[model samples]
Target: MNHLLIATLLVCLSTTIRAATATPPPVPDVEIVLRETQPLTFPRGSRLPLYLWTPNFPTADDAELERVLKALEARGIALFARWGGNDFAKASAFPLRVARLQKKLGLETSVDATGLAHGFYNGTPATGHVDKDGKRFFDKSFFWSPGCPFAVQPRYDAMRARLEPWLEKYQDEQLRLDFWAADWEFDGPNEWNSGWASARQCVTCRAQIPNLDTDFAAFQTAVRKVRAEMQREVFVKPIQRRFPNARIGNYAMNPHDGRRYWWDFFEKRTDGLPAKAEHGALYRPWAREFEDCGYTVAMPVIYTWFNLHGEYPFANHQYRWFYNLLLEASSTGRHTTPAVPRVTFVHWTTTNPPKELPKDFEALTETSYEELLWHLLLRGHDTFAMWCPAPELAQEVRPVHRVYAAALEYKEFLDHGQPVLFDVPKQPGFVVSALQLGKKLLIRRTDFGPAPAFFELKLANGTTLRVPKVDGKCLLLTTP
Candidate 1:
């Protein structure tokens, strides 16, 4: 590859680049492209894609949608609109309308699939309620299951069929599909729910995988193969027929380890995935296959409290694990991986409150918001999604939006990819990581604590510089 071509691809983050005099606050982090590993370009010069959900319920007024869009645009943000599946499945014309508005705002539109198993006569054999081992509970009336008698292949086929015309009409840059809903994932602890890979016992699924035992790994693999075929034959083909340039994606949830209270399934490691894939062993099924079949993956994590603990302990833990998994996935460098790791930060506020959060729990989450932003700034995320909670709690959740707005304003400068040179041999409590984008350098500082560290930066101008902040537990430096 030409140096320019190589620069465009495989942009690495490094720490030892020469710094220039402090100028314009570093160009806003979101617009900074420290590395260009692929031919990826940000629309409107934004780095991270900031998406907000425009749902059908508590229906957003045209004025509200326009207002939010303008706000996001002003802050260098983007939007992702959802079309109802259970309540508005194939009936509402919102997706098309939303797409038109998206085009007007120069925004990329994404459609969400709702009733895979919940709605009537659409597809799959799913009902609003599910029976796990003998106990039963209602699934949020969002998705219809592939196993529902009415769902089967035709039901899913219909979803794709409906999308074809619109996909052609819009030819938007990316598409997102949520084929499975929350009930499918194991709840960790004592919950035995299927987590998206549920319901293989259905007659049609059983007929296909006759010897399918109730093994989590096997069931996951079977579902993966089936879903991929559907995307390839039904969804992808139809979209390609209509618009060949668009990218398609969907959301998946991670399964919790038993110790953390998820319905335990794999006490030992499962099959098909590599041992190294253990960070998020439960959620990688489609992640691996989506890559094989060419699809984008979005993992939505629901941090709902089972018994209403004020601290949002579970949600906090889930967020950390999800972050780790995303970091692992990006570092692996596999394009075939179907999903780009992103977090759909959701807060179920109608019922639960943190027992011991800051007097203002919402404000405390702002710190989390900052941490999340810091992580994304370092890791290079594709998008940041926030889920819509119930109408009553919208006021409380508005702060998150504010924080997102503040973060995006700085995205362009944050993305410039500065270098943090590391002298591995001399550093005692630090480890070095680097990313180089085009002509820029990005170097991260990680201090393991207990001692001092030293590092050197090799700049583009043939000069060597040293990072001076190597004394603390966590140090971050940027090149000028």
Candidate 2:
């Protein structure tokens, strides 16, 4: 009897082993790994600076739209056009028109998904709310609240789940949740009207996460577990199940903290990272989250906010000082994307200006547009997505679009080649700096003092040349 029992036990153990090693359920059929090994460096391939905007730009008639599209086609600029979703129109009226433009020009299109605001899938409508602190407020007339039942994370999951069919249905190369940025920061001007204070008090949030009588720390722990599940069930899982190969990313709206609590809550919900991380510590959670989840994250900074003059100009200075730091933080553990304010955006120049510039600034004597683009590029960003204002506004802005187009064309040249040299000198004293990438060179001129001084670019092949009459005091020399 003992021998028989031993033999039976061995057989059972073998069966268990075989079951454990039986291919692990086919690994979910998702290709999380890529053939390319190293982290994807920016400029993987060049993409022109993009302009993101609603088709409802003031005075944006059909003819104007066609003209602007033609201009973008000629300049090879990508247009991140927001399909009209507001009361002005129900569905995008320009899809066919834009499609023809893209096909004719070989351009790419990503829909401006405003579903979060439109309450398309399952996002919470922007119900006016009161904060825990007893402040009442509401997002602007068009914006919607992102607060939803934790159980509805599956709704978010389904939101993207619906994207796969849309992609195949539309034959799209990429999709951008353009305006559906899940921003929860309430620092602008609202008084917190809804009174739905604290995630702990959230009815759906509480149901999704039990243990309310637990300590704050313990509750936080529970929230973390649920948050992970939410992310998986909501964003990542459904995305993998549906598209499997779709390039997905969340668009961040708030620029850098400044009364913003979205990142803070997001960090806590994800991994308890502090919002005020000393010198970029706050970004690790999102970075780690995106990396682990296998997706891209886009954080858009208010680069246009750096030029506010007067007492506000000092604020702009503060913004400038923190710009690079913010980029570093946002890119931490994640890929970085830099987007500039489109020259076409009229308010961009008037709203954001160096204390020295006028309200309706026509030209900038201190900094050139190319210098701005180069600076954005140097900060380790992959794509350039900007907001495009109207054509009349573009014309009034001293033709900055012309400068933008030129820089974009040059960007294509620089992306594949190595930069051999670069230099930038601020105005006044002609502060000059030069840098070399591979076979290309960049030279910059700035206002330091008051001296008309210049630098010469000499190549290893004994070639010499002077700077051109460029909008921004910048120069680029590339090899074939």
Candidate 3:
């Protein structure tokens, strides 16, 4: 029979784990062994920062839905959110449904207020971007007509109108509205899905903008200013007026890293001279403009876009590169908005995927997927707002649940402890990161390559503890 695991795990670590020759006085040698690792239990007061939000998290009827919800809840998901459920047209239903979810599951809901703001996905003719001919910009693509709307005064008024009902319904405050974010699609001044330069052709552009044809930098700045102001006035401000405690932000609201990455879209200009995506590379970040948006929470969309491999000719990228990208994101958020908490948006699956993986192609393995999850928390982002697929919820997310459950086990260190090692040397065919809490240190070392015989970890107090390898899971250990 499997035995009950206890807090007195040090005894097992001390005895079973093979140790190097000498032991220093203050710090003792130890390594924990996961005997009967199955049926991972949630810590008594689990304050794990892992959140799971499905498409329709709260569907009133089905027994199967409840089963999936309970299973997800059991997986030590500390927070729940509605990624998509309520109608954008009538956002009044949003607050009530979330309230119902909170009452039934006994977990708070992180609101995705995309619809709360008045902007459309692909804005309409009356509201969307209009050229001198009064036609929308980027109005038609091969698959869809992605209309980019300019942030003008009329839309702002409509935003307030749409918000009144949501505001009135949300006054009840039935659920704890802790974290809030908006996945406002086709937002911002861009050359992609929407158009920024197309505004040059706009009649309003001719009137509002000075030297519209020549001064592209001014044009970029102007459009960004209008968009940010709209976001602040329409989405963030109203929510703050009602729910002061809400940690509000918009998705991809982190520090802009310069011009967009290379792709098929408008690579017309090769010279790095102007602040345009067309310029190849020259647009400086609009630091003041980002701050003006008034985001209480810095929500960075840190998805596995490259899992080190996004292109057709697949390449095996190093683990350090991927890990450092996550670190950069977390650090960027902190520097940009030091006062605000970082609630990173994560997707377990690669957002940009190849149509099919060749037999020889090496993408992220299952173990690597788990490691990515750990690194997100290890880098000290407050929590994750995860998006899960609708079908086969339990099985698809079971591995993630394990990672979450494991995280809660050391909630104290994870919450309070600072990361001593961010750039863990990728030597043992695996990657590692360490968190320190006073004398004791907790390490999360996950294997990506072939299983090594053993590896050594040096502590804060100058002690080296050699740890044996574990299979099929993350190797978590604490030094004594």
Candidate 4:
């Protein structure tokens, strides 16, 4: 046989063999129950997708839950069942059922389990801290006293026991071990204050580090050591061994607060005393651990409060800084990989009642929400999660729907295009977010105050695309 003919025959044979072995993707029941609707469209790029963070109400009637799932499906959103606190075994069932229901409804869902970094006293009595007088210190925060020893072994065993059965049960689902490292500090000299003082009182902890309190440097060192131990013993090792295939991640606080706190600490300002210690150092090691164990890691960019209060106008800058810091640290040999840093733009207070809202809280305007979404996208973050406590609130609040619609639109635009080089113009008062996908380039211009008459985009091919005003705002432009 001729060489070319033989090669073609071999290719055909390989293709046939692959086809014979290939397994079909699961067909969801919802697809059959409800006819597929037309995909949403955006003027530029594609629709942005949203993940709904619903409270994990275990006792909610199945029918009501299904209705909620169906409503979310209609809106083109996925569900994120939020379950916090201890009692993992009991709480695990809620998310498991939610996941099952979502799968049954043909909607997407993640298995979210909370892993408290510092032990909770009420949930696990043994984890509480005793004062010098032998009285247990109890605080509203639920964090054990600083000098108390974290029941690392007990917590780890409990977590493993609780999660193993679920992992085996839902072998196909992704498990997010949302680390509620509540009140852990990431900056300054006071970084270890969360539990250090009380931790020192624990006999076991004191035996290990007798000088933890007396020596500030020793306390910091001990805190780092304990953090690493907790990351390994409490989370990474057990999860990797038991649920090897699960998509695991920890909950990270909004990076802006961390940055500002650290900035203030380093500047010796008393106002924003460091909340956590050495933000980068605290997260970098954990990021590496997640990457090494083949798990997903997320850092949330919480711009809602700032946007609401209007304290920070240029919040995106801080977000960009935080992301870049992590990116740089997580980068290896000029490429960033499975350290797949997911930046979740979180707006948790949307569910707060009007009376409960902060004094500085201003209802997030649709324009502001859209602008923030675009700003984060421009900074190279696509994954987003919004905490909407109740589904009905989306209807009650017009801007919530508007914000979600923009996200869906952005996701659609992204799906249709490949990201290319884009730069922020040096000129003041305006910023341009541009991406060239295929033959067309989608550009969105955002102005600080008044809308500019028009902005000119100088493309690589020496083409000038003039983006004029659309509905009194600088909307997206598609240029070849």
Candidate 5:
């Protein structure tokens, strides 16, 4: 055989053997190139602002509040804080009667998560309600407000009296907020925290659903409508009755597609997940509740809770985990024309931290954490709303400020630009997503592993990106 032919035959044989093996080893020095497509577009005159919801700073002293507000203003935070007293006052901004530090610092303030759940949705002992049989409505869980359907209507009238003070206070235009979210999650007529069947075994609920004994589906359907009714009457009507233009929504209101992720991977067991019997089946079916309530903004959540991150196979990395949540938000949250503004509540801190993990687990470092924010913006989310713990404030806010600076640096692209490359490449190690407006293409790429990476990124418009090696950090670049 000729030397060239003999050499080619040996190379082909080696390649064939490698391909024939099961679960072939990862290729070294892999090159990944992704094309841009399916950008979340914005209509003319509408722009997504760079916003952050900071925990309330000291408002007791004029000088101290101004100093803190000025410091955050310098860091490019345009939004922060909620309002009210008791627990809600902890998040209150501009609460000082003599001081309005936000005006001085040019930071915007908003209200968040009013304690509706705290006030009315606790167990019957706490909520002070009884079933038609003169027994406490409490069941296996404290979130048992689904009983006595007739009792809920009468409770709403009483709620109006208590809610009046807050609404009256915000009537001051200077104190008014354009956004509001309710603290009604995990406390309504839902099956997650506890089943409503026990509570609904009453005169009123059974009267409405005469055959609830034989059919649980009727109870489930009726309770969802009851929850929707609660949202409209309890949260929306009361708040919107005061501020007609306000964008109103609540936490966990966005349809979650009936799946909850909690500590389990492709090759792991489900022993660590929260028990179904204790927490009930984690399911929130789409009920068109937001649409019925006329929600202006979709309040979907993309959290970095370590335990909640492990249920799916693709969630091997924090970056991948957050991206999946974002995918969930954008897919279900924006399934309409003139997409509802997704002012998503995102957190990078380890909420519900798992007790143990795979030995090779990668907690979100500085680069990976910041990448979460950038991906949210590039994935069509309108704002980055967060609450940093006071102790971890300095470290966590590093990513927030850095991402905010990029928002200012590329304001045009962020303001008017639609995000391209929303679909990520399926391969591991290399991840790329982008945004484009007209001729401007702003792409964000982060490769896994320690070594610096350089790769070619091809675009559908016949443009190719050749950038310097990104040393295991997020790379945000624009191409004209």
Candidate 6:
């Protein structure tokens, strides 16, 4: 009897070990329709910049749509469309038009879907209670409002129902979720101080925190926890399960004021409740979470174009901020997943300067456009997507076209080469990147300052090469 019992225990232990060591099932095979497209190649380790054009699909007529599509394709640009708005059902038909146009033009017609983070309301009765002011809270702007309580089961179920059908229809394409959380900071206007603040007083939300009504800390903690939970469980996990093979990209906002509310809540750490953490410390973990969960791309859309003029004219201080954040995040040994490349989406136009530019600064010049792109490329960003480019603004479009031509001129070197290698003891006002293609070595240096500057490059063989100032900020050199 004793021998039999020992043998049974050993057998059970062997079975448990096998289960633990077994590999997970492979992710479903997803059909990539536009794998050959230029913009689609960036996610697959290509160094080329992915350019996307954002245009309203439902309202665009067939002729106008074709014109825009052809124009963008001529420049190797891809279309990024929003999937879940009030007119989403109607917008579903837009993809068919895009596909047909691509076929007609002999172009790859795959449109990437943009899932607006807070735009998932199905127009049904609430399974949750009303806010303190007896108002229904829904997202009014791109950012999250405290009034919108998305923690209720009914809301999650409704959102899943609405999203699943759309995902099923386009299971083969990539989906990018934008503005994934609230943007609350001291710098911005305090819009949440009114009824929006009391909107979190829903029954389900209140049940999560005992002292939510009286304790401000408790209310903040509860709201953060609910938002993170909804983001992960409702927004992220279900989509992953439904479309196991689709490429999921998240546009996580790197909150400007250094408050990592989502990261703190997700980790259940309340010690630094009200204090601001370093930007890298906050965004790195948030990005890692999505990366580990099979997200192909994660980009922090820095929403501070208005504040750019306050610091330096057309300087793109935000790009430098994001670059430093990426440097800090990578230095820590915690991010074990695949390295996610950086992308910048800048709001640059002539007619509408968000705020007044400095006295000596011009609005939008060819130099400003060129400098921004060069800085992003030198600082380690893989792609740059402009928010909106109005063709009507001929002055602005002309400069943009010039820069686009320059990018295309260097596509062969930029697309096929390895990551940019920077020089040690980096120059103060200049940034340099070197790439070797076969026997030829190409070095590109960009000057960030207003004044033209000269530089020198010393090779390992103790040979020094002098670089001259060009007409523009960027200069590309090839060695024999």
Best by TM-score: 5
Q: Which stretches of candidate 6 lie over 4 Å from their true place?
A: 1-52, 57-68, 85-89, 103-144, 147-154, 171-246, 250-294, 302-304, 312-343, 350-364, 389-397, 416-428, 433-442, 448-480
lDDT of 4 by residue, 168-281 (tens): 555556433322112223311123324444555555555666575565445545554544455556455666665554445544422221122112111222222223333222
Model 3, runs deviating above 4 Å: 1-49, 61-74, 78-106, 115-151, 173-175, 191-194, 206-219, 255-290, 306-339, 352-354, 358-360, 392-395, 420-432, 445-480
TM-score of 3: 0.67
C-alpha lDDT of candidate 1 relative to the true structure: 0.39
**What is candidate 2's lDDT per residue for 1-480, written digit by digit as tens?**
699999999999999999998876422101111111112123223453434332232224566656655544444344443433343223444553555455555555544444422332123433223345544333332233434323334344334444344334343434322222222222111112221234444544446445643443344444344433444454545545545643344444212323231222112222332234433223222212323333333444433333222222222332332333234323321232223211112123433334576563343222443344454444333344443344323322223334444444446443543333323221123333334466665554444334444445566778765644343455665634
The lDDT values for all models are 0.39, 0.38, 0.54, 0.44, 0.54, 0.43
Model 3: how far is 267 from its true place, Å?
A: 12
Better of 4 and 6 by lDDT: 4
Ranked by TM-score, top first: 5, 3, 4, 6, 1, 2
Candidate 3 local lDDT, 284-328, one digit each (tens): 333344477888776666555532342322133435335434444
What C-alpha lDDT, on a 0 to 100 scale, does residue 307 get in candidate 1? 28
* Model 3 lDDT, residue 302, Cα: 58
Winner of 4 and 5 under TM-score:
5
RMSD of each: 17.8, 24.4, 14.7, 17.9, 18.1, 22.6
TM-score of 4: 0.57
Ranking by lDDT: 3, 5, 4, 6, 1, 2
Model 6 per-residue lDDT tens digits across residues 1-480: 698998999999999999899996632111011221223222222342344434334346788777666655555455455454556568667665655565677655333444434533433335223556655554333232333344354466665665566656554443332212221121111112332234344655566557655565555544445444555565567666655433345444222222222221112223322343433222212212333334444444422233233333234443332233233322221222225444444445532344556565444344545654554444344554544544433333334435544555556555554433444221225555554454344455655454346566665555565666554544556542
What TM-score fits each model? 0.53, 0.49, 0.67, 0.57, 0.68, 0.56
Q: In candidate 3, residue 377 scores what lDDT?
A: 61
Per-residue lDDT tens digits for candidate 5, residues 275-382, read: 333122232333456666666777666666564444444544654565455555555433523356776666667655658776756666667777766766666666
lDDT of 6 at 353: 49
